[model samples]
Target: MQNQGLLKELIQSLCCLPGVGPKSAQRMAFHLLQRNRDGGMQLSKMLARAVNEIGHCRECRTLTETELCEVCANPLRDAETLCVVESPADVWVIDQATTFKGKYFVLHGRLSPLDGIGPDQLGFELLEQRMATGQIKELILATNSTVEGQATAHFIGEVAGKFNIRATRIAHGVPMGGELEFIDSGTLAHAFNGRREF
Candidate 1:
C-alpha cells in the first residue's frame, strides 16, 4: 500500500487482467518496479504493440495481425473440415497437440445465459455463412465440457442439421472443467480421434 499513486494505479489495472487477483497484481507490480524495471518497459512496449496490431481473423475469428489467421491461410490444412472453438487460445492449444489439421471457426465465446451471452454473441451467423460456402463437410465442436460450453455446443448442433454439415463434438477424454490448453498431447489426440456425432 505504500507506493506512488502511479504504482498503485498500475497494480489496480493489472489486477483487472484475468487470473490476476489483487495479491498477484501487487507482487507483479513490485517485481516490475523494483527488480525488473527494464523488463517492465519491454513488457509495456510489447503489450502496446499487441493491442494495436492484433485483430480478429476474418475466417475463424482468431486473434491475428492480418485478415486471416495462419491456420486458415495455410494450404496444407484440410479444407473440408472446420473445427469450432470458443476462442483463439483454443486454437493455439489444439495446434500444440498437433492432432488437428483442419481450418478453424472460433466462436470467441459460449452461450452463457447467466453472463448474457447468447447464440448471436458467439457469431452463429458467421458460422452459417461459412457453412453456406458448401466446401466444409465436417463441423467439429471443440468447445469445453463446462455447462455453458455444453449448452453452446448443443445449440450449434441443433442448427448444424439445417445445413446438412456433419456436426461432431470432441470426446470427453478431457477432464470436466479442464480447458483444452491444459490437456496433455495424448489426451487431446485421443479426444480428437474419438470424436462423436453431436
Candidate 2:
C-alpha cells in the first residue's frame, strides 16, 4: 500500500530545510503529527509571516519589517563612522561582542564571482551614495576572515578611499579562550601584526 500523500509530502517538504536529511525530515514529520501538532502549526504560521513581511532595511540592508531598521533610525548612533559587515547575523554578533556605537552597512553577502554576486549585487552604489553625502568619515570593514570576505573588504576600502573616507579593518586574533596550539597560522599572523604596545 502507498503512504498517505499528505504525510509523505510533509516529510519531503521538511527536508528542504538546511541540515534536514530524509531521515531527520521523516522524524520531524512524525513527531509533529504524533505529539507537536499545535507547535507545528504555530511554526508554520510564523514562518509564513516572516517570509512575507520581513525585508531588507533601506539604509543598512539588515532584515527588518519596516523601511528603516532600529539601528539606522537611531539618532544617537555615530553617523561619522560606519561598520561594514557581510550579513545581519554579523551585525548581531558585533552588537553583542563589542561596544561599537557607530552605524552599520550590511553587504548581505560577499563577492562570489562563481555565485554571480558582485559590488552591484551587494549594494555598493547605495553605500557610495551614503559616503558621497560626506556624513561618514570612517569605515570599519568587519567582514569575515575568508578570502571572499577579505576581497569584499578590500573593494569597500577602495570605494571609501575614493570618497576620501578613512577605512579600517577589524582586528583578527585568537579568541579569549582559544589555545595557541588550536589557533590557525593565519590568525596567529594577524594577532602578531595587530599586537599593541604594552
Candidate 3:
C-alpha cells in the first residue's frame, strides 16, 4: 500500500544504495530494527553529515569537505603530473594501492553519449583551466579499461595536446600473479603489445 508505515519506508529508502535489491534492503532494514538500532542510528547520523557536508574539491573535483582535497592541498605532491580518473573512489583506491605522488582529477564518469554523459558533465572546462595554468607537465589517464573509458582518455589526450601537456595511459593487462595460460586473449594481447625491454 502507498500508505505503508516507517518500516516499509525505511526498506524502500535503503534500496537506493548500489547493488541493494529489495531483498537485501529488507534484510538490512530488519537487521537494524531487530538487532542493532543503535548502530543504525549512528550510521544514519554519519551518512547524513557526509552527504550534507561533502563537496567537490575546487581543483580536482574529488569529494572533500574543504576547498581542496588532501592530495591537491599537499605541497609535497607533484603538481606537474596529474592523474585523471573516472570517480572519487578511484582517487582513493589508487592512492591506497600505488606510490603515485602526483595530483588527481576526478571525472565522476566517462563519456557515454547513449547515457547522455559528455565532457561538460565530466567538467572538462575545469580540467582545461588546470591545464591552462601551465603547471601540469604530464597527464596520466587512469580511467577504467572499458571502451568508453578509452574514448574518454583519447578525448582528454587531445585536449592535453592543445595545452602541450604530455599524456600517458595506465596499462591494463595481466595481473602481477596471473598465469599466462589462464589469462584471456584480450588481456594477453594488450600485455604483449604493451611489452617493454626487461
Best candidate according to lDDT: 3
> Which digits, one per residue and each the tens of the lDDT, describe model 3 over residues 95-134?
9999999999999999999999989999999999999999
Stretch of 10 with least lDDT, candidate 2: 1-10
Off by over 4 Å in 3: 1-4
Model 1: lDDT equals 0.89
Instruction: Give the root-mean-square deviation of each candidate in angstroms.
Output: 6.0, 1.5, 1.9
Q: Arrange candidates, best TM-score first.
A: 2, 3, 1
TM-score of each: 0.81, 0.93, 0.93
lDDT (0 to 1) per candidate? 0.89, 0.94, 0.96
Candidate 1 lDDT, 154-196, residue by residue in tens: 9888788888899998867877799999999878997899877
Instruction: Decide which is better by lDDT, 1 or 2.
Output: 2
Point out where model 2 deviates above 4 Å.
none
Q: Model 2 shows how many backbone clashes?
A: 0
| Model 3, CA-based lDDT | 0.96
As a TM-score, model 3 comes out at 0.93
